[model samples]
Target: MATTNLNIRTDKTIKEQADQIYSELGLSMTAAINMFLRATIRTNGIPFSLTLNEPNQTTIEAIEEGRRIARDPNVKGYHSIDELKAALDV
Candidate 1:
């Protein structure tokens, strides 16, 4: 079988954390990545469903408000992805 080299850039912290996790799972990082790539190719995308939790009335209202605020043309200085994610406490 032929082998190819692949390079991906990620934050150092994330890479370290992933390495630790894969080690604990008794897998190498290369093996984990290869598994993910094979699954993606087989399904033409990610192999799992991702669904958000059902929002209660208050959560729904907050989401609607956030959408309204985001839609405002005058709104300025949108938060960075990480900042928004932090704000959502996710």
Candidate 2:
């Protein structure tokens, strides 16, 4: 099989970091790229997940509020599920 050269433009810092990682894995950059290309063709799409894992604004607000409540000494702390149920009068 004949292989052709592929050229791409990327940040110098990113290339350096990737080079270090590929070296650590005992692969050259070319081999790493070929692995990624083969995986993309086999999968018929991008090789891996490309989604945002960040929480939405509402979730961020709730997490912040929970942290504030945790630091507030006046907020009652429950030692067990029974105590929590009793606090809710359930």
Candidate 3:
């Protein structure tokens, strides 16, 4: 099979991490990329599912509220599980 070079831009850290993973799997970067390309061609598209794993608006609002409470000095903090359980009356 005739092959050509393929250049792609990715973060340095991401490349380093991928390199480690490929090394552990007994593959080079080129081999890993070729496998991905072949899989893509076989599937007639991307070989893996791509979707947003984002939190919903209500969850986002709750996370922000929790952060605000954490930053507020007036908010009560329980130091132990027993204390938390007592506060919750459980």
- Per-candidate TM-scores read 0.54, 0.64, 0.61
As a TM-score, model 2 comes out at 0.64
The digit string of per-residue lDDT tens for model 2 on 1-90 reads: 997889999999999999999999999999999999999999999999787999989999999999999999999899999999998999
Which has the higher TM-score value, candidate number 1 or candidate number 2? Answer: 2
Provide the overall lDDT of each model, using Cα atoms, as 2-decimal numbers. 0.90, 0.96, 0.97
lDDT of 3 at 17: 100
Task: Give the C-alpha lDDT of model 2.
Answer: 0.96
Per-model RMSD to reference: 11.1, 9.5, 6.5
Rank by TM-score, highest first.
2, 3, 1
Instruction: Please give the range of 10 consecutive residues that has the lowest summed lDDT in model 3.
Output: 48-57
Residue 32 C-alpha lDDT in model 3: 97
Per-residue error (Å), model 1, residue 45: 0.8
TM-score of model 3 (CA atoms): 0.61
Please write out the lDDT profile of model 3 over residues 6-85, one tens digit for every residue. 99999999999999999999999999999999999999999998879988899999999999999999999999999999
Higher TM-score: candidate 1 or 3?
3
RMSD of 2: 9.5
Report RMSD for candidate 3: 6.5
